[model samples]
Target: MTRDTQGENAPSDLDLTRLLQTLTVESDRYAERFGSRHGLHRTDVNALALILAAARRGEPMSPSALARELGLSPSATTALIDRLEAVGHVERERPSGDRRRVALHVPEAGLEEGRKMFVPLAEAFADSWAGFGPAEREVVARFLDVSTEAMKAVSAEWAPPHESQRRR
Candidate 1:
């Protein structure tokens, strides 16, 4: 298929690849800075940050939902949740009429403990983007959104169904 070369669709795979790599490195630097404060592994801190952010956003996502959203396998998600729970960052709960379902909630300790480290790191990155003009920022944002959607589609096709469910 011939590619469009004018505007939004003009970027080639090479352009997208380079942008992805740049974003990954920048994000990792932020994550590493944030992780250093917690004495937790990078993945653990990232997972907790995700869960806490979702909780604060009123998403209150289940472990299965988190695994799907984060593109993590069920076992990996469970382990991540376990670590958070152990650290008093989250609580595992089963509300009435939902005996088999587990929901994760952010505890006060998690918020108080992690926010000092995480918030500043996030703000630093946000501040860096503040220099972009509106148009430039919009272009970058759209590219990221589209790229994310493309990965979601591709991952959905390949993710194992058996591993999709919350682990026992």
Candidate 2:
């Protein structure tokens, strides 16, 4: 039996955590650089990406959610949303139950434009992934799924008590 860093004979999530942190840093840098090439501000590009992601996941994107995800002030998020809306990248619709809340949707044109800009990078990733066998890819997929769940759980349960107040 092998021992992990804790010196106990057990498997651990430490590897996953380290890999995730490195991947997040490099991926964000790549996204920022690539988005800059397309003439969009990094934060604006990040917001657009988030909104698109939410739509793809069949979840609604509201300004509040975007703010938390992007770590932006509410006013900053509103401004970012306003810019996206003005450029036809996103459209804000008031949800039926809450007129005060804005639900964001990406226009088809925006998706098309994003695809045009990101396809080359996606192709590069596909080429890199080509080395992985099906079994390896499946394991990676499972790891990512579990990692995402872990992140969601911690985010929900472990924030500082004054964190929200500090923002206000």
Query: CA shift at 144, candidate 2, in angstroms?
Result: 2.8
Q: Which ten contiguous residues of candidate 2 have the minimum total lDDT?
A: 158-167
Model 1 bad stretches (over 4 Å): 1-13, 32-39, 67-79, 96-100, 157-168
Candidate 1, position 120, lDDT: 80
Across residues 1-168, which tens digit of lDDT does each residue of candidate 1 receive? 234465555666777687787978988887787667665678777677677778778776689887866667888989888887877777988868979988888788878876776678779879998889999989988978998898778877776766555332
Q: TM-score, each model?
A: 0.65, 0.70
- Give a tens-digit lDDT track for model 2, residues 10-108: 555666567789999988887888667656688988889888889889999988989888777788888888888777788989889888888988889
lDDT of each: 0.76, 0.82
**For every candidate, C-alpha RMSD to the true structure in Å:** 5.0, 4.6
| Clash number for candidate 1 | 0
- Relative to the unseen true structure, what is the C-alpha lDDT of residue 92 in candidate 1, on a scale of 0 to 100? 84
